[model samples]
Target: VNKEHGAWKCHRCGESGSFPELQRIFGDEPEAAQKEAAARWLVFSNALKVCQDTLLDYPHILKYLRHKRRLDADTIGKYRLGYMDEDFIKQMRAKGYNMNDLREAGLIAEEGNRPTFQGRVIVPYLNRDNIITLRGKKIGGNILQARGVSLGLFGADNVRTHEGDVYICEGEFDTMYLDQLGYPAAGVPGADTFKEEWATWFEGARRIFIVLDADEAGMKGAEKIQGILGNRARIVELPVPEEEDSTDVQEYFIRDGYSLEDFDRLIESYRGTRLFTVEDALVEREELKKAEGLRLGWKDFDHWIHPGILPGQVMVVLAKTGVGKTAWITQVLHNLSEYWIFMDGDHQTQGPGIPILMLSLEQTKAELVERMWRISRLWDPWMTDDHFKLAYRNLRLNDENRIPPEDVRVLIHEFVDDVQMMPKLMVLDYLGYWARSFKGRSRYEQVSDSIMELKALAKEFGVAVIVPHQVSRTGRRGERLELDFARDSGVVEETADFALSLWAPHSKEDRAGGDLGYMERADVRIEILKSRHGGLGRETRMLWAPASLALPAAGERGFKDLIVKEYEWLDRGLLYDDIHKRHRGGGV
Candidate 1:
């Protein structure tokens, strides 16, 4: 701690300042301070050649690098790709990189001295020549999940030097894939994060193409980037739900009957940035009124939910198992599809509305059709049993039967051939579907990317995307449900424009004997967790029908509602006044 001019100097990171000032820059936290020092850490990757030679020993890694990711030795050498093992750690330690330094460089675990990304292909995050950070793509087991620098997004420096449309993806492999194809690409650390300042790097670019995961967070993050870039961003929706991530672009490229030209054609079809002018803003306000937003068809939900759902919005329905999450979303989809179909439910009168695409990855199309048919007989007052039977067999149900995903992805090419191409609402049965299509990253990224892609599809088609999800057990443990209970709750809260969390809100004894009385309780415990442009924090109690497995309408109580009779016990207890005071105090 040598002092120069009455100030301490950090010789390692080259900082001259007061102790407090230095501390502010480096921080009191060990990891923070180490990272601060490592920010400007300049060192070339020494393990490159040796790591590449060792790659031959791990034939699996070699095959993954060459065949799976389609990366060559030249690209590997250019990026200075390396491997980190016990020996490599020892060599680094011998070379004077202490555990702190290794941790700072993302070479060792933050909590331990062990090699953080050992037994995996290491991709260095280079700032010009010096490696600033490192990420490890696991060779097997769950190959999609990778360990990256805890802080900082990847691919910022690489894309900054390029010209023309820069493809923004969520994975380093995706960035690598694009660069291998002679395209400029950058990657965020995760779907939820994008270095805000990095948006400025493309100030002179032709356009910014965001090819993030096809899930909620990725799409929301892309929207955020679009806000930053304004009209310079052209968002591309992934054609195959399975291959939605940009990293999967390689697999799509190598697929039969596909090439760079074919891929470019898809890009060309989705090419354009959207911006709003003063006139467009005024027109959009009018459009919102005319459209009246997307609705769940239940009066109470519609009453509390102003303007209902909107185009380019994402709504997640989260509940515990047997809470009727799927049933709720299905009924809402039925309500929405009625406006679409280009014909009425009876198939006699012409109905002119956009189509609804139901992506039921969890449920079969036949099962969904059966559910819709039953709901139609009961939910629609105009339809009789005869009408239900005739229309059920005659009319195409679930829209998937009408326009299957296979046809859109490969079987058919002409979108303008029919208006069926654009849907007003797209209902995905569950979030896990994304992994089935693109399991190229971590589970967090997988879920995030799936929601992001769904969000993108919503905006791309001017539709509202609805996805039903199961809340983590934590959400079910409490008397009051919290948004934090959802699995990947952080991403869910951040990405969804609107979210509804449901719980029974009644005790076991009050459950009313069985499925017949599930909703007979005072409150159904449905809370609106978030709303991008509307009401929030308001809880709505809706009519529940276990027979139809539907939350049909708002309870008749209006503003005045009471908890189930069991709450009388709270009032009858000793220290009731004190308990009431505590409750009132907390509420206040």
Candidate 2:
């Protein structure tokens, strides 16, 4: 055995090999340790020198770093980024380095006697000035590492020394991108590759942000890391669309046009999983007081809602089958998509319409476009569906394709990230349709889980969600709506910030007069059954014009002749008395 190089020679059998080769041959014998580390250091340094000198010869590798990966020359040279071409083994042999030593250093494969990192970008893990290990990153492929090199964190020494906030990214390129921009960052080989023992590496970090890919695997990894680090780590989610396949930082900042300032703002805005202090609660309360929530463009309805619908709130709308519940909310969505002018003290405050995503399981795209046309034109009796379809060929609404129940939460994140805005509203047509997708589960459990998920999603993205719900048959038949009528579970009423039910005074009379398709006009009353933000049971009336699913606003001229009354505060005592008189002698 040669102690200087950790190499051994058996004269009788004529066998020769390095220490790493021996370790690989006999799996992890900690007792048989290598004392002479200088030999390995010599091989590592020589291999890196050869790889770095030959990097510029590969134009494709340079193009990938400069164009696709958005890396600059300084970044490439600073990190000692290199490329190992197909002839890398030949170059190492030309330098008089032995094949066995190269294989033991992880530059060559022992099986085929070929270069281990053939046609891959070589990234060196450094401890200050000394090289730790070499990682081979195949373009759009899997990662390759040294055979026996046990690396700690990718940039452990850098992170340990960094005094400011540190970002732990999912891959090498993401870390390099942040590092090049003057931010402190480290790389994990993959989503599941972060080790529990590596948590101590961030001891000197002021704050650690786990900015992983916003995918299922990445999220699970983030959860694992949060478990390890406890309150010391905060997960930074990327704004990635569901339709998009990529969710890395490179795609978010380079491809999606997100800037460094945007990234900084996102980091600053995020309030991790920690509980809020009393001071934090007081600050939030004051912020909410000064904020103006989204308005539905209806005079009376907006007044009844007072400050309108705030972000991070879920509002549930309930009605029977043909009570125009969908139509009314469709109008609200349209109103939200247009700019509104309102008086704020002395000067008029005008703001752009809130971007919206309408996820509909009940209506088709064509049907929704038809409703948009109807609301836009105010119940045009002369325009046929075929004619409207032809006239408005380019007409489009902020809508989503039919999404599966499981993908609803993912799609919401995608939509919010794609638009890059907050206070954006998502109108899920109804809650029952989503619950029906979960087979084998009881209706009660399905409904309960669905609403709870929505509440969490609302708070997560800081966006308002409006979900229309169906009332129970008994509740629909009653003279007034109740909170218990929120479909199968009471969770909907309990979780939502506002619970509203739409009612038409003579719905049965209207149905008896003609088929629903032939019905032209109806007087609809919106009953505020439950309000966590304001008073409950406030009533407002609107006139549904001929053939129009939504109610016309008070400013609308066509509905003026219909003489729809204004808002009225409901008197529960008088309402019960009227109901009693109507049901008198028929039933107790």
lDDT by residue (tens digit), candidate 1, 1-588? 422112354555433433434556665556765555444253225544445555666776767788977888877677776665567677766666666666554455556566666677777666666665455667653221122223344666667766776788777777787777877877775665564566667766777888876544566666666656766686665655343433345545664336788879878877753666899899977887787577666665666677878888899888877666677776675555432121233324212233555566667777776666545533343444455544332222233322222232221112222343545566777765443453446777767766766675566567777888777664333266677777777777788998887776764345544443323543465678888755677776665443334454554432112222123333355343333333221110
Whole-model Cα lDDT of every candidate shown, in order: 0.58, 0.69
Taking the tens digit of each residue's C-alpha lDDT, what string does model 2 give over 167-252?
Answer: 88888898899888877888887675576778778878778888989887787667567656766788888877767865888888
The candidate scoring highest on TM-score is 2
Range of the 10 consecutive residues with the lowest summed lDDT in candidate 1: 557-566
